[model samples]
Target: MSKDVQERGLEIRKSVLGAEYVEAAFRSADDFNLPMQELVTEYCWGAVWGRETLSLKTRSMLNLAMIATLNRPHELRLHVRGALRNGVSKDEIREIFMQVAVYAGVPAGVDAFRLAREVFDADKDA
Candidate 1:
């Protein structure tokens, strides 16, 4: 990774993702997954996402759509919550999922909605 990208990426990840979350993710990961996690931080978050072409807001919604289309409920849920930290609103999240349904199918939407409700429920009690 470029020095600038690495510096900016760490700042972006820390600011948007929160240091505690990033630290937790790092601490919880084993040696086998270390490179995979670092690569994602260095490339996915550091390279593609760290670009100034689009705001993190746009990226968050896009990620939500992609995760939903791929039926990655776990990742989708993580991003749904992450979206808020990325400046995506709850209503915006619903709309993002709605758009995803149009291209990815109704089932994808049904699952996303169910997941949304669960997250919201857990968030409420938290």
Candidate 2:
């Protein structure tokens, strides 16, 4: 059962985060982090992202907002790329960060924008 969910999660994770990102994660996993990786794959991506109530784009937006609210710059950077791949427009992402600014504090929003800029610029380069 966990295996099935993990497999599904791996598929969703690869699709949203890109094969390169997911592959790098797996490639970097070791004794200490491998379990954590499997848990996230099974639970986060499989259980949450695999749900049908919301589309992938909506989930990506939610992730962006929540990650920004938490002030998790690293995750925010990663999810910014995922959000774009999921069909979220750059303007929409800016608006989402604006909402974060209003509710999650200006600092959080500012940092989120900074991280987003890095991701957007990388996309331009790629």
Give each model a TM-score. Answer: 0.88, 0.96
| lDDT for residue 59 in candidate 1, whole number 0-100 | 91
How many collisions between residues are there in candidate 2?
A: 0
Q: lDDT of model 2 at residue 30? A: 100
Query: Which numbered prediction scores highest in lDDT against the true structure?
Result: 2
Candidate 2, residue 48: the lDDT equals: 87
For candidate 2, write residues 1-126 as lDDT tens digits.
477888989999999988998999989999999999888999999998988999999999999999999988888888999999999999999999999999999999999999999998988998
- Residue lDDT tens for model 1, 4-97: 7766676777766668877788899998998887877778787988889999989988888999999998887777777888888889988988
Q: Alpha carbon lDDT of residue 50, candidate 2?
A: 84
Candidate 2, position 41, lDDT: 91
For all candidates in order, the CA lDDT equals 0.83, 0.93
Superposed model 1: Cα runs more than 4 Å off = none
